[model samples]
Target: MVAEKITQCMKPHGEEGYQTIENMNENHKEISDFAFECVNVGENDKILDIGCGGGVNIEKFLKLTSGNVDGLDYSGVSVNASIRQNQNAVESGRCNVIQADVSDMPIDDESYDLVSAFETIYFWPDIANTFKEVSRIIKPQGQFMIAQGTDGNHPDDELWLSTVEGMSVYTADELEKYLLNAGFKSVKSFKKENDYILIVIAKK
Candidate 1:
């Protein structure tokens, strides 16, 4: 049911026929790139990436920073695929990939300088609990960021949101409210085309 639930939202046609990466590149890359560009990775900052997928984005950080980088995803396929794609980073100890559910990450509290979730949160079964866990794993003044589509952005938005109960195009105000409620000090967002994607920078 867990796989079914999440995959249903990702699949444009059916779960088995879904090619998330391929579909995304066609219509959602601009939004994804926009959010990804906000990372602002300074030297010596520890970074954590939730739902690392195939590690294309994680590789960007690994190449940009000399500091430690880690990623977690619920899908074993995704984690392994990422590991294979970024084997250099893994071999150099600059990056690591783990299989974990967002709501129950294996990382310790205050462990990272930045945490990012790219196209990942809408599938979360409990956003509050996941936010709490992500917040707990960052240091003071550490940040948590998410890259997501806004209303009327991605062509599949309506179907995706419909199949997944809590899935949404989070407004900046709504994101701020939720992040603040989850103990983040601040939250802000931006727009890409019709998509109102959030690049939340929440300080602990």
Candidate 2:
């Protein structure tokens, strides 16, 4: 029951789950900052943040780029929270939050210059197929950045793997293969020294 509760909070579906994500954003500021540094966002790059919880990263991306930033989450609760958090940006026509699943995104093809997935791929339905979907939505030469706290080789992840049902931790090599097979032109991975943090960047 405890493990199930944890998973539910991670994928947030309702009011309580929305509160959980709000709290998570508060405590995960450092991890989010680390992930942000790995991506190279341009001044005019339109970006989409996949699984953007509470819209914190969307706010951050706004500061990083002068371009529009969009947030997509599978959870309606999360979508509402993200809109609330980024209300000013949305009102200014700078940001948009939508309830969307990664495997089946409701977005136009070749629309964005950058797509970022931060610590959210574990719950993705089909990792490979989702990568293809991400590729389809990105413009040619667009970049996809995936940031996770685990490198799949971390000793601590064994506990998360065992406890979190339907969660899968992927290694850099595994992710590289999936990205390449999904039609990415190049893939590169980076890790924080002495830490399990892994950030993989792929070009379409």
Candidate 3:
């Protein structure tokens, strides 16, 4: 029963999922902020947040960039929450929340200046191919940033893996390899001091 609730982190659904997303927004703030500090955000840079649960990060991006800030999530519930969280931006034509999968995003080629994945990607199907899809949508020389609470060495890693269905964790080395193979030119990773937080930035 507990495991089922944990699975909602992959693709949130109904009422329980809604609560999970809200919790994620609050819980993930620090890591998200750390990620932002690591990357450069231009005043007019277009941005996309993949697995943009509850749209908290989207709201953050809106403040950093004058260009459109879009969000994509596979879960309908998440999409709705994101839209609600950024309603003013959406209504003002500065934001768009889309329901889509990472492996096959419907966005146009070379559309964004920055693409970010936060506290997500453990549940991605075919991660290598999905990275390629991310590459396809980013403008040349644009960047991709990934931030999560684990570097795959956390004390509770095994417990979470066992508890959450289809969840997987990747080390910084593994992520760098995948990003490079998927066409990123260079990859740099940062680990928070005395913490498990991992942030990787890949340039295309």
* Tens-place lDDT digits, model 3, residues 33-109: 88988889999999999999999999999999999999999999999999999999999999999999899999899
- Whole-model lDDT for model 3 versus the true structure? 0.94
Query: How would you encode candidate 2's per-residue C-alpha lDDT over 1-204 as one tens digit per residue?
Result: 554425654578666786688786887676688887778889999999999988888989999888999999988888888899899999999998988789998899999999998888988988899999999999999999998888999898888877776789999999999999999999999998888889999999
**Model 1: lDDT of residue 119:** 76
**Per-prediction TM-score to the true structure, in the order listed:** 0.82, 0.94, 0.97
Clash-forming residue pairs, model 1? 110-138, 150-196
C-alpha lDDT of all candidate models, in order: 0.72, 0.88, 0.94
Candidate number of the best lDDT = 3
RMSD from true fold, candidate 1: 4.1
Candidate order by lDDT, decreasing, is 3, 2, 1
Query: For residue 102, what is the lDDT in candidate 3?
Result: 92
lDDT, residue 150, model 3: 98
